[model samples]
Target: MHVPDGFIDAPVSVAAGVVAAGAVAVSLRGARRELGGERAGPIGGERTAPLAGLVAAFVFAVQMLNFPVAAGTSGHLLGGALAAILVGPYTGVLCVSVVLLMQGVLFADGGLTALGVNIVLMGIVTVLVAWGVFRGLTALLPRTRRSVVVASFVAALLSVPASAAAFVLLYALGGVTEVPLGSVLAAMVGVHVLIGIGEALITALTVSAVLAVRPDLVYGARGLAAPLKLRVGGELVDAPAAEPAPAPARSPRRVWIGGLVASLVLAGFVSFYASANPDGLERVASDKGFDKSVEEHHTADSPLADYGVADITNARLSGGLAGVIGVGATVVVGTGVFYAVRRRRTGSGDGAGSTGGGDRDTAGSSA
Candidate 1:
């Protein structure tokens, strides 16, 4: 959730800023590995990098559709599950970061001052929890395509509440208001549980659909292959062999474009149906009396407030235009970040290869 300013005290917010910065630093390095070398490169380049932007836009759109969970509380797509499924973990973090930044600047959805905290809670925490649980479940279950989907469901389901708990801890440590800690914790975790179910279902379905079409594109599905079998005395005997690498599927450019279109349509057309109720966090804040100190967004007058163009009388057209602009902005920012990471990875790989080659040549000459 996009935590506005004053929800958390200044000192904790600044601490979160440091944590967020550190996480991004780690993600950049991790992304280089995920996107680097011949092992994962080709896919990382045409598919992963471009699709990263699309993931951000998709996350942005999905977030707008906050489904009601309780009478006063609702939940929206956190994008952590979706992003991790579509892209590698490191890039997934970056994707959400892009969305958060855009929301803060363009829509004034979250406070710029609290950007770091939002990133840590929503971006880093979600990715870590989702990926960790997804991997653990897949490893323990029967190795089948269905296992991946199931793992996705469980992982996503757990991630939301985990994030809520994180926020609760932060507030407990540095809450600005004197709200009852127990009440805040219970309310947040309780409603977010329902939202987590929605998150799990959405993550499972989306991940499964993509896996069916292009399993190669999924980072978590890498190296998962059906077990080998052999005929022995007219009966099949189980044997194990390294799984053959998957072939490249459709060009990433195509996937990226298609995903962007889907995101635009969803935000532009479908988001109007999103629940009007406050999300789980907002509801908790309001009910718990912590919402009183909440300040107005600095960009409240932005043209895209509530996702519509300024001075546009036509609700449908204005909202649509705003959605499209958001998608475009997110894509531009996300792609730029990923492209730079890809280049750095490429450069590092080239340097390593050259060093190895030079060492070999020197040894040969001496011999």
Candidate 2:
């Protein structure tokens, strides 16, 4: 959930900011490793860059449409497990960070003063918990496609409550208002449990879709397969067998366009059907008296507040336009950041006594 300003004290917020910065820093380096090696290809890079942006925009849109879970309480996409499953964990952290940044600066969904705390609670903690659980389950469970799906479900389910617990712990340490610790803990955990189910389902479905299409691209699926071997004349061969030809690399433009269109439809159209209830954090805050201290966001007058166009009067058209714009902006910003990271990595590779390229040439002739 997006924590607003004044919920936590100044020192706690600053500490969270420091943690957020470190998380982002670590993510940048991890993203480099995750993007490097055999996985490093032009098309894969193209796909990942825009995919990261789409993730940020998608999470942003989904967060706006809260579905009612109980009286005065609702749930939305926390997006930790979804991003980690679809992309690598490091990139997932960046994706959530981007969404948080946009929400604070553009839409006023979260507070500017408490930005770091929000990122720490929502971005770093969620990603860490989800990834940790996912990895643990995968290791223990039977190695199969079904195991991956189940792991995704468990990981996502656990992440939400884990985040809520973290919030309670933070509040205990530095809450501005004096509230009963037991009440805060119980309330946060209870509501977020419902929210976690929604998170699990969404994460499972998204991971399944990606696995079906490109299991190779899923970091969790890496090395799960036995080495490819084929029988010839009743004897097994040591050499790996070639599979059917791979489909041609689809243009990045097509994938980007399709993702943008899907995001717009979900945010602009389906969002209209979303339950009109305060999300889990809001409900809990109101019930727990935490809402009393919240300061009005500085960007309350932002044109895109509540996900509508600045001047457009048509409800459908305004929201649709806003979704499209958000998708475009996220893609541009995300792509720029990743490209810089990739370029820097490439330069580092070259400076270390070789060409900037990462791999050693195995080909006998130039293509």
The C-alpha RMSD of each candidate to the native structure, in angstroms, is: 4.4, 4.1
TM-score: model 1 vs. ground truth: 0.91
Q: How high is the CA lDDT of each candidate model?
A: 0.80, 0.77
Cα lDDT of model 2 by residue, 256-298, tens digit: 5666777777776777678778888888889888899999898
Backbone clash pairs for candidate 2 read none
Q: What's the lDDT for residue 340 in model 2?
A: 68
Q: What would the per-residue lDDT of candidate 1 be over residues 244-361, giving only the tens digit for each residue?
A: 5865445666656677888888888888778889898888888889989788888889989878899999987887788888988888888788778866655444334433332232
Best by lDDT: 1
Off by over 4 Å in 2: 40-47, 227-256, 350-367
Q: Which pairs in model 1 have colliding backbones?
A: none
* Cα lDDT over the full model 1: 0.80
